[model samples]
Target: MSTTDDFDAEAWRAELEGYRDRKDEFFANERQSPIPADQRDAFDGLTYFDPDPAYRVEADVTPVESDETVVMETTVDTEQEYERVVELGFDVNGETATLVGYTGVGEDRDSLFVPFRDKTTGQQTYGAGRYMEFEVEGDVTEAETVTLDFNLAYHPFCAYNDAFACPLPPEENWLDVAVEAGERLPEV
Candidate 1:
């Protein structure tokens, strides 16, 4: 939930680049990688938009009065249930926007899960959506605000291989602006 106002741009960019490098190494070497085993030999790395501080945004967290159980459709013919927990309000390219954060139904997690689709979907990014999660320090209900770093947004495993089924971003989470940050199409 760190703010980017006083962030060291060089350090942030370096850290992000290091993360990307590690991820590439995992994809190319790990057996658990999302890239199909048959395609692992040719796997290079995931494409990414250059890291930009502008994509790191601060969001106002508004807890939901009644936590609603929502069934989200997946890339395949399956559904998963999640509890709608909070609304995250932020700005993107001068446009104010909101996205809902959720958690697995009947599960207590240390982080809030946010899946979303922006104008970059089906073009520059994954068609289904990308995901970002931030660790909650204490009770999420008591949180006033959190940071939504699009620079850390990433495609689900399904994006790399169809064998994996990932939840689609709810319609309410579809963004109108193009978020030109984070991982793009897989090179598998």
Candidate 2:
């Protein structure tokens, strides 16, 4: 965990709000939106917990040395393969926790994938889980730390429609703490 001494709470909040607005626009208007065609007429914006900087924390990134492969099960009957990349350790609301970060096998090397569930799962948020992904600067192996903005957490497309097969968060990445940030359960 790192101190937010240099964090600009106001700016961060503004940026997050903008992001949410753009996403809502896409979901409500885009033809490729995850919202079902029948529900598009009444489609509203996604629900989100208030943007709180407390949910945005700096995480220490510990790279995994082994070439470990994780077979993540999807919402459907299929599975996806990903390489275990790093362990992100951080503090959220005074609770210490760690989550595993992964990268799709043979996919973008710079993007880090972190699908996880919290106390909010199956209640205030998506029952399956939420996902957080960010681009790592330079090499992931050299990444010492990264920002984990839970305010950016979002539900997978499968949450809105069953046609999309989204990967379920592995048990290893489940957090005991209630991450009351980012998109909440859909109104539908």
- Which predicted model would earn the best TM-score? 2
55-85, model 1: which lDDT tens digit per residue?
Answer: 9888998988776688899999899999888
Across residues 49-88, which tens digit of lDDT does each residue of candidate 2 receive?
Answer: 9888778889998989887799999999799999988899
How do the predictions measure up, each by TM-score?
Answer: 0.94, 0.95
Question: Per-residue lDDT for 52 in model 2?
Answer: 86
Residue 60 displacement (Å), model 1: 0.4
For lDDT, the strongest prediction is: 2
Poorest 10 consecutive residues by lDDT, candidate 1:
1-10
Question: Cα RMSD for candidate 1?
Answer: 2.0
What is each predicted model's overall lDDT from 0 to 1?
Answer: 0.89, 0.90
Q: What is candidate 1's local distance difference test score?
A: 0.89
